[model samples]
Target chain A: MAETIPLEQVLGTWVAALLTLAIFSFLYRDNPVYKIAEHMFVGVSAGYGVVITWREAVIPDLIQPLLDPAAVDLAGPNYVVLIPGALGMLMFSRFFPRYDWLSRWPIAFVMGYSSGLAIPAAIQMQLLPQLHATLQPVWPAGEVTWWMALSNLLLFVGVLCTLAYFYFSREHKGALGVASRIGIFFLMVAFGAGFGQAVMARVSLLIGRVRFLYDDWWMTLVAPWFGGG
Target chain B: MRLQIPLAITFLIGLFMAVQFFVPHEVFQYSFESLLAWVRIVGAFALVLGIGSLLRTHWDKIRRRRRDWPYSIVTIVSFLAMCVIGIGFGHEPGTVFYWVFENIQVPLDATMFSLLAFFIASAAFRTFRARSTEATLLLVAAVVVMLGRVPSALIVSFGDTAVGHYLHANMPDVSEWIMNFPTVAGKRGIIFGVALGAIATALRVILGIERSHLGGGGGGGQ
Candidate 1:
């Protein structure tokens, strides 16, 4: 005999749907029902983050290493991580005006280190080679079609105009002004193509979610009856 | 002392890292990896701060009964409910957290972003008129690329075999080439220039010449 479905689960499902629809109602206009859902979402997300941080980072990365020093091998048992960890904790000290300055060390370290890393890498990887590549192109290896030749020429032209778009040492005037305008048009076309690609990606994600809800979840509940003794 | 110290650190660290990149030493590589891990940890903490602010802002709105206050309440309730289910109940697939995330979050995010499609179409319709030689070229290129992208273009029967295939192959190839070769190359060039400028800026900071980021007095306080 089939088991009767529980009312609680049914109610939970309905609550979930109501909440989902409430949030979606934002597309029409902002309303109070949406605000409650948004606030609840923020609280829950924070709570989730706190839990994950404790489980994933604090417990595993920081605490575990301290508790069993020999078991942890990554950076060796220097009291260094403890210094930053203490500073991170000191950030809470900002709530008390007297001890707030203690938080500055970690903040400074974070800013200093990030800029130190990002600035250099951005120069080397993104800047230099790209500059060099723009100036040169490898000639066709063996045979060449007119189409290929035309494509290469267009590519070179596009690169030049795009580069011209950002050239602001002097005011864009005469030839420079015309070139920059052309560059912007090319950039817009590129962006339009990218925007299309982004739409396609989001569509696939929606389809995947719908499939999980309708096909996977529904089948799990219904499929057992087909093989009944 | 507050801003000056940080600024000084930025300048010195920036200079050091740039030098380290050119040097092929194991010490530099090790330092970089360890530093990278430290930065990642700090970044995660920043995310927590952002979430706290999001909760506070919404809660205050709900409390005051501000215009559109119900939306804030709804948002908070749904958020908290999901978090409890996600964290407490283990946010595995088919669970409450998963159900809400899959059903609500994914759809809402997608739909909001998808609205851009209609906006783009309307904008294109308004702007894509052929007025000049340059405009005509652009319109021609757009139509050609649009047609070439989909398989349905083959069934449109613009002509017989020859001219249509030429349009199909050539226009798309040109568009693809423009994107892959020129557009990419141009972007890369700009990126490189910015990078060099960054290196210069970082060097200036490290040496204490450029201290604008550290505040008005520069490195004098340090």
Candidate 2:
């Protein structure tokens, strides 16, 4: 079965092993092997990004509109694609120091549009939805379990106390201090849970690499050949 | 002239788009549809600009023959090689481009991120001491969650299957309850504050009060 494997796949697997080991070597110290691997990784990722952007975005959105015959019916020869196409071109003017100021025009436009777009959308999407979900009935208009009531009460009190911690306009010398203290307790619990979850995620990633080393590279390539298995 | 015009543009464009959200009319939407197309193209171009900057930095290092400049050559060569291969041939699965990405890039990235596990473990060991009440509480809560999340298979190996099952059920339930109640409550408070702050910042930028983004090069027309 190993002999029947394609040369490219075997080679790719070997290269992958080398790259993985190189990156993992950073655990010891930042050595030559790690630096080389890191730089290569950075370069390849950027290059891949460019290829993807061109293939997915540029050709399809900007070029195809003008080139495709059906685009006439869809957008009525909307040479509107050229508007951004030109702006995108202007972005490269950063390479030229004299005309670099021209780059700011596109930057301003992008920033302005983004700021405008995000402000309303953030409110509509995140702010309002989260608030609405928080404010829903504990009983939910149906069966009333103690568990449900208790959880709802916890959630409501938690939100209020948490908000009180952040409300800095009032001095925290009295009752506000008490609510804030409760808020700190709630926050610590949240942080602990979140941290635990994150640790698990990172451990899973380490397990994956170790699994690859053991199962994919060594077991497949080395162990069977040596008759160790 | 430059500062005023650009500021006006930011203000008007922001105001127009924000107003567009409220307006159900086709005219505003029609204009928006056009604006969005440009934004996508510009965003893609922004990525190219970033890549150019990265390449230029490495190219300069190589030119100057800085310490470990040989590594800069490796970066440039790898970048160009990948770029050429990707552009010359499509990046479909099983292609050389895809293979390079999956084998070389993916593994490297995953391994780098996985290194954080060791760092986190060491940090935890150092930080989990019970010097104070708050620290003790934090350490205890962290231990509980970690134990609660441990797989039942591991627990079964240590003890009885029945005990493992009991641990699995209660542990996950307790962990989830902590997340659902306290986490949501704390996170929601933070979210409201963050959202308000973001809104205020956005308003400042739109109104041209935040000219810091215009860059020290020419924001003041100096």
Superposed on the true interface residues, model 1 gives a C-alpha RMSD in angstroms of 4.8
Per the 3 Å backbone cut-off, how many clashing residue pairs does candidate 2 have? 0
Tens digit of lDDT per residue, candidate 1, span B1-222? 665556555656566666777877999888776665555455556556666677778789878988776767665666577656765776666676666565555544554444444455567788877886556655655554455455346546665677777776676666565557544644554565677777676556556676554442222233
Top-TM-score candidate index = 2
Predicted complex 2: CAPRI docking category: medium
Off by over 4 Å in 2: A66-78, A92-99, A139-141, B24-30, B151-169, B216-222
User: What TM-score fits each model?
Assistant: 0.72, 0.90
Task: Give me the TM-scores for chain A across all models, comma-separated.
Answer: 0.73, 0.87
lDDT by residue (A1-229, candidate 2, tens digit) is 4677788888988999999999889889999999999999888888888888877777677877878737435645558788888878877777777666667667778888988988998899879988998898876767888897889988888888888999899987688999988888777777777788788888889999999999888988868788863
By summed lDDT, the worst window of 10 consecutive residues in model 1 chain B runs over B213-222
lDDT, model 1: 0.60
- Candidate 1 error regions (>4 Å): A1-55, A68-71, A74-78, A90-104, A171-185, A195-229, B23-26, B77-108, B122-148, B153-175, B197-222
Give the per-residue Cα lDDT of candidate 1 at B78: 62
